[model samples]
Target: MSKVVLITGGSSGIGKSIGEFLTEKGFKVYGTSRSPERYTSSKFPILKLDVKVVSTISDCVQSLLEQEDRIDVLINNAGVGITGPLEEIPLEEMKSHFDTNFFGPLEVIKAVLPQMRKQHSGLIINVTSIAGYMGLPYRGIYSASKGALELVTEAYRMELKSFNIQMTNVAPGDFATNIASGRFHAPVNENSPYKTAYGNTLKLMDSHVDSGKDPKIMAEAIFKIISTKNPNVHYKVGEFMQKFSVALKRILPDKMYEKLLLNHYKL
Candidate 1:
């Protein structure tokens, strides 16, 4: 029997790519999208779900349950990016990012965990980013959200290990996705604060994203990962990110590593 996988943020980009990829392999995929019409042509089941809104989670899960009776894999891939000076970004925007990127996944997990525990088997793959491991200028909010999810995923895996629930943290390096070009007017600012200081760093992060690796590479990596019975606690895709973090941790001194990061962003 083919396995049933539920994915959040499956409307487009990496999330949509993974959903289609898994569907081709014959898995029954239930994918959540804010705009269900956008994915009317997708291979898997498309359901309307806005990750930022907590109330929508259970309804979506219930819809999936009616179809498959159980969820074998739950992948949290929904997230948003707000790039700019952290100080300039409003507190409400910061909270919005956390609510969507972190708490959204937590809610989904809480809904599905009981079913997995009853089945005595399941896999949870979180689509985090390299920013989770290392702080980045201009992307502070995004990085912080991913980092918190990483920690939560760690505890979730530890506690669920006895139930045979496997967890994998997928940290993709810069990937060629439409995220950098996505919608959003510049957030309204109460006042122009730290304008000059944050300009260069924000430009640097945007440039790095422009030169990111292909998203398909990361999608293929995900396919290989879940196919294995014993998956690693964390998997870093893309050479640019894998080498960057590993080298920083092993070769450079603490101060030197910090200096390199700052230099990378021309800060």
Candidate 2:
């Protein structure tokens, strides 16, 4: 039987591309999305799913279970981004980001783990971001969401290794995805309590969205990881700045990194 792979948020962006690439390689692809209409001409199943909705995830998984008894891979790729001064974000906004980006994946894991455990073999890929490893200006919540996921992936890899099931954390750099256009952006006001501290950096980040890495590159990387026999537990894929940024985050002291970030953005 052909293997089955499921990707959340697969209507477009990296997930959509991964679905297409994987389908071409003979995997029975399941692409879950809130807006299935946004994706067209894929030779795989496009299921209506919204990660923020637990029922949506469960119903989608349950439907798949009835048609196919096994799911070989689960790509926890659905996420939402909230941008604003971390200080000014409403508590609910922060919680919602966590809901879509972190908790949502956990829900999917629980829904799918029974089958994976029964099979005694599976791969779970968590789509993270370089920001997870390094705090970035105006990217605090997104960074936090990915950071939380990274740690969880590590723990899962350690725990699941013996079971022959595996976990991989993919930290992709800035990429050309609808995430920039789709994120919830809190209106900024210098007079707002936290804006004065992060406004400039946020502005810079907003401007860079147009010229980051390509979504296809990220998709190709994800496809390879899913196909390979021995993919790394942690994979970083992107342009030079992101690589440099991650390296600096690892080598520099927190205060020094702060200084560099502030000076780089003229904050």
Question: Can you tell me which runs of candidate 2 are displaced by over 4 Å?
Answer: 37-41, 193-199
Which model scores highest in lDDT? 2
Clashing pairs in 2: none
* Residue-level lDDT tens digits of model 2 in 5-106: 999988778888788888887889998988777666766788888878889888999899888989999998888778887777788999989998999999
Model 2 residue 138 lDDT? Answer: 75
Return the clash pairs for model 1, or none. none
Output the worst ten-in-a-row residue range by lDDT, candidate 1. Answer: 183-192
Candidate 1 residue 93 C-alpha distance from true site, Å: 0.7
Error of 2 at 91 (Å): 0.3
How does residue 135 of candidate 1 score in lDDT? 72
lDDT of 1: 0.80
Local accuracy of candidate 1 as per-residue lDDT tens digits, 203-253: 665676787777778778888988999998888887765557855766778
